[model samples]
Target: MFKLNEMAVKPVMIADAGFMYAAKMSGQASHYDLFTPDAGELAFLADEIAPHPFYTRGFMLHTDNKVTDLVQRAYEHENAAQYLLVKGSTDYIMNQTGLLFSVDRPSVESMEAIGGTGDTLTGIVTALISTGMNIPAAAYAAAKINRIAGLYANPTPATQVIEIINQIPRAVEKVLKEDHGGSF
Candidate 1:
């Protein structure tokens, strides 16, 4: 539906929320490079029979403990992109083959209650991909960066997403210096 082949440059396609739903519904999910789906959304993608997220089977919803199963199901049904960044208590970075990595350390529990944290993650991954980083690496880095930003924010239930976002620069600096020998 996107007519990606007609584009002069085939840009890396990353989808989340509504865009991700469109990709899955269009049966063009394979055309995308990455999908950032939270656990509940992953259920929607995994339910091949469901026309939309709201219709996903009750049994399949919010099964965070079975994320690997959901990932496998989504891929088997061709409802996922080439790569997936499953965001939750533990962020899972995966490719079509299987799970590649997981990031759970430096976890900021209060970040979960804060709105837009996931959106921030999608933005970070998009920026990393735009810089020409491969999808999987970008996803992994973005997960780490997001968590670091949240840690820097020291968020509370009262904290706003803008507070976490404000720490992004410091987070980026810390991640690059620590993970990439200060050269990224």
Candidate 2:
């Protein structure tokens, strides 16, 4: 269990594509403080993007499949996250001002087939927030750290989620070394 103290300034949110879908379906999608969705889920949010009075879906597979466009649309409408993290071949981090960052390196394509990876990302972001990191920065770091863990795990189609879990500390270490001059 977690406790909130009066000094706590960071707002923690943990949600994925499924929850976003259900919320949108129930007309409460915009109520979330944050959302972490993949490329396909970004498309789902674009269903109601501009020039339309009603919502639509599956347009992600259509000509509107561009991830950036979809993310922009979602941020504009759908009452989406004040900070949005879209996971995919290239992870995108966005806030109301516009795209904050995009992390695409140390890529492991097989990570897509691995289950619980997205959940791992949520955990990483939450932990960062608990330390009082702002949502957008936490999310940006989370995306890169999660991918670095996958690379450290050297994932294969047969690789299980545990391998990725085991490499998280090392991944964080690597990111810290690169970003903090090996002090962490």
Candidate 3:
């Protein structure tokens, strides 16, 4: 979905908290499924509305937990771009850039507040998409790419978003040339 939309225009991250919870309970990883909504993410959504007053649209959710519906509704308004929720979330939309990446991972039980694993997954997606591979391939290559990125970002720092993006192009080239060659 994300990749298909990319063919048309840039995409807004529609995060459905309730839906996310369902996915989580159904065995989906919280990070890849439903991570916290952030400021940057909200800003991206706000930008989606050309004339402002951003109306609620599609939202694919996956989480073992969620906030309130009021919180979600509150985001439907002008200046919503500044809203924290829109700024920090994602979905399987094929917005302008197409399905950039979709990554899932395990969530820590009992512990809340920090979703480092989610961050790592998002980074993995970014790297895969930036590599110029197709959406399916990018999604498929996430685990291996993530493992390589993990080595570069270890210990104290842990999650390195840029590191993932930076390594993507080279990673894609290596994989394509070695495995498929002219097959594709």
RMSD of 3: 12.5
lDDT of 1 by residue, 1-184 (tens): 4587689998888999999999899899988989999999999999999998989998888545498999999999999999999999999998788999999988789999999999999999999889887788789889999999999999998999999999998987888778778545
Ranking by lDDT: 1, 2, 3
Give per-residue CA lDDT, model 2, range 1-184, as digits (tens).
0343243653454568677777656655565667888766667776664222134554555764677777777766664666788888888888667788899997899999999998899888878777777787778778889999999899998899999999999987778678657432
Q: After superposition, how far is residue 111 of candidate 3 from its true place, in Å?
A: 17
Clashing pairs in 1: none
Candidate 3 lDDT over 1-184, as tens digits, reads 3373456654322223333333223433222312323332322232323222133232413232232332343234222211121112222222222233433321222112323434544455445456555444544454444444433333234433555555555554554565468232
Clashes of each: 0, 0, 29
Among these predicted structures, which one has the highest lDDT? 1
Q: Which stretches of candidate 2 lie above 4 Å from their native place?
A: 1-11, 49-56, 181-184
| TM-score, model 1 to reference | 0.95
Model 3: weakest 10-residue lDDT segment is 79-88
In order, what lDDT does every prediction score?
A: 0.91, 0.75, 0.35
lDDT of 1 at 2: 57
